[model samples]
Target: MNENSSCCTPEDSRHSGGTDVQVGEVTTTYKITGMTCGHCEGAVSSEIGEISGVSSVQAVASTGLVTVVSKAPLDEEAVRAAVDEAGYELVGQGV
Candidate 1:
């Protein structure tokens, strides 16, 4: 499988620097609205995952929340744009 597919499996604490690097896993939860079904979840997840530095995304329609877990240096604009592109509005971001 490719590198991206490999990442989809799980989150591992392997450092390419060949050292024990403690990467800060910042999980930002975004409150979104207008998500009505599973397709909406897929769209939001895909859009956010395309942004650089965004390691993974797990979006839930019922909760109207999208949890994005990534390493340091997150682009807030990119996250917002991704949500906008998915035809949803980001109410707020925290955590």
Candidate 2:
């Protein structure tokens, strides 16, 4: 079997809109500072999505929440770096 076959079965793919299943993936939510608009959200999302192993990112300026999906838990330092690159501050992990 292919390396990814064990991660998800055909039925699982059907439920996810036919997207490839990410096995062993983890999700994290972080509180971000200085985001005030859609542009800010896009910037933060773009920066975080560029990190290795990151599969998806969602940033909400109104809530100051940034959710990240990746193959594993990301290093705090790495997240800080991405936030910094986007001209923002990583306040901390979300509650």
Candidate 3:
């Protein structure tokens, strides 16, 4: 692929009925359950960071939020799997 080529086509850029926006980078927030401390946050962030294309991950246990910034929109199932691997439950995208 050329440098100008995007991993996702225009149609693939939008997820869950256009809720996710991809412009150079995509930032998606996922709600999680069972995160009650800093250790939980670190585990979740580390797991999600291992996913391909993920640039950064910030997990806040206080709010049970895991914000992932990536080069492209990520597959929800993959995210859920990461959370599961971190010993947490992915409650889907945040509202």
TM-score per model over all chains:
0.70, 0.76, 0.75
Off by over 4 Å in 1: 1-22
Alpha-carbon shift of residue 62 in model 2 (angstroms): 0.2
Predictions in order: lDDT: 0.66, 0.73, 0.72
Worst 10 residues of 1 by lDDT: 1-10
* Selected candidate, larger lDDT, 2 vs 3: 2
TM-score (C-alpha, index-matched) for candidate 2: 0.76
For each candidate, C-alpha RMSD in Å?
9.5, 13.2, 14.0
2-53 per-residue lDDT for model 1 (tens digits) = 1111112322211111223347877778888876656667777777887777
lDDT score, candidate 1, position 61:
69
Query: 1-95 in candidate 2: lDDT tens per residue?
Result: 11111211121110112235377989788999887766677677777888899888878777989888889899989999988887788999996
Instruction: Please identify model 2 stretches exceeding 4 Å from their true place.
Output: 1-23
So what's the TM-score on candidate 1?
A: 0.70
Q: Please tell me which model should have the higher TM-score, number 2 or number 3.
A: 2
Error (Å) of candidate 1 at residue 30 is: 0.3
Candidate 3: residue 42 Cα off by (Å) = 0.4
